[model samples]
Target: MVRVGIPRALLFYQYFPMWHAFFRALGAEVVTTPATTRATLAAGAARVVAETCLPVKIYCGHVLDLVGKADVVFVPSLRSLERDAHHCAKLLGLPDLVRAVVPEAPDVLDVDVDLEKGTLAFYRAIYAVGRRFTWNPLRVKRAAAIAWAAHLRYLDWLQRGAGEAEHDSETGWLNDWHRGLTNVAPLPITIAVVGHAYNLFDAYACHDVLRRLASLGVAVRTPTELPASATRAAIARLVGRAYWACEAELIGAAGCFLDDPAVDALVAVIAFGCAPDSVMMDVVQRYARATGKPVLMLPIDEHTGTAGVATRLEAFVDLLTRR
Candidate 1:
């Protein structure tokens, strides 16, 4: 069986399900690296220049972990997901960056995901990548169809789970989100954590930020979990137009959350040295300042320590509770 390695970084958190289903349908055993840790970050960081962001370094680490463990590593070049939309340099050149940095890596399977070319181009790129695993076009089509269904379902799941994030403290249903929080006041606060999932959800990159916020007895919402219509409308209203692939989610969701009265504050999680993140953070900060809503910008890097993140989160939550 052809063992395919998929790094658990970057788009992995967003598209891993579809990739898993696609590879499985093609009769390949999928090999994944363990969850992010300090060692993984360190190993991957040493291979790249110091200026690289935490997520990219972590991706390199994951690719390194897959060496000698799989026949090939799947690293898609996700240039643009929408028409006329462009991705940051990190995403557009991920496959090449891996090839340059990780010399010991096996074959890296990559497919261009630039939709600006046209709808047909999108299909062609996906099929071309599919052909690498199998020669049968019928099998590949079936796999693609299955993967498409799974992606839609995953999006639906994200929205459903996010919509249900509402808690009724009177009925005692808030206990579910009250884990790890004690000896502190039960402040009924909700915050929108705006950033890419790679930074917000990655344990090592952000020092388990989402869980940390939850443990502070605060409700959390992320861009990926928000409704598509609300986020899209917010984006259109805020900036008039956007050209970046993640703008709709990151910047749009931040705008939506900032304007939401139910949300007390907007907590922006970002990676240090990321150009896109810096722009998004600046936009969010300005909107927040204009509206008088509290905003906390937490930028994580390879040197970010757990104690520091914890202290900052605690301080931020304390400020929110006092507000």
Candidate 2:
């Protein structure tokens, strides 16, 4: 059986279940890199050029960790899900970038998806891979369908979990809700965290910052849990200047927290050298200052150390408490 390695960085947070289901159904062994740590960050930083953003550098580090452990490594090339609505250029260039950096890298399977072109484009790409490996297009299609269904189920579960948490928060039963669902104790301070979906959820790459914050009695909220439409409305009212796409959502979430007295502080996590995030961080700081809400900007990269992040977080929390 062939061993397939999946890096626990980037989109792994969003599409992992689908990837796992599809590959495992094809009878391939899957190996995932361990959670991100100082060592992993250092290894990744050492492998990539200094100019590369933190996210991509860390992704390279993850690829390196799985180099000899698998027969193939899956590095997807996502151009745009919608027409003229592309992802960060860094994401579109990941596969080629990794290949360039690690000549001895394992066989890379490039999965390209353009949602603007239509769903069939996606199916065809996967089908091509299926034919290359298993020689059975029918089986591949079936497996893909199964994987898609499983992915939907996982999303539904996340929504349900978030809904329940909100309900508990409303009723002042947050402690019970946190214990029953997440098994983590609630923090005395509530923090609003803003970042890309991948960075927000990838425990390893973000150094498990959410968990660390929770352990220190801090309740963390992401834009996913915040109401998008309302946040957009708030952003327009607060900033006057509208934000675009992910930036809009992030700004909206920050705006919502800034207006609400219950949210004690704001934490904006951005990848080092991310152009969009760089712009967003400036806006977030400007907004925070105007609103008189404490905001911490955390820039993460392949070489980011957890100790530094933890100390900063602790200081931020202390600042919030004092204020």
TM-scores across all candidates?
0.91, 0.79
lDDT of 1 by residue, 32-131 (tens): 8877888889999999999999999999999999989999999999888777668899999999999999988989899999888888988888789788
Worst 10 residues of 2 by lDDT: 168-177
Indicate which candidate wins on lDDT: 1
lDDT assessment of candidate 2: 0.73
Please list the residue runs of candidate 1 whose C-alpha ends up more than 4 Å from where it truly belongs after superposition. Answer: 162-187
Clashes of 2: 3
Model 2: how far is 218 from its true place, Å?
Answer: 1.9
Let me know the TM-score candidate 1 reaches against the reference structure: 0.91
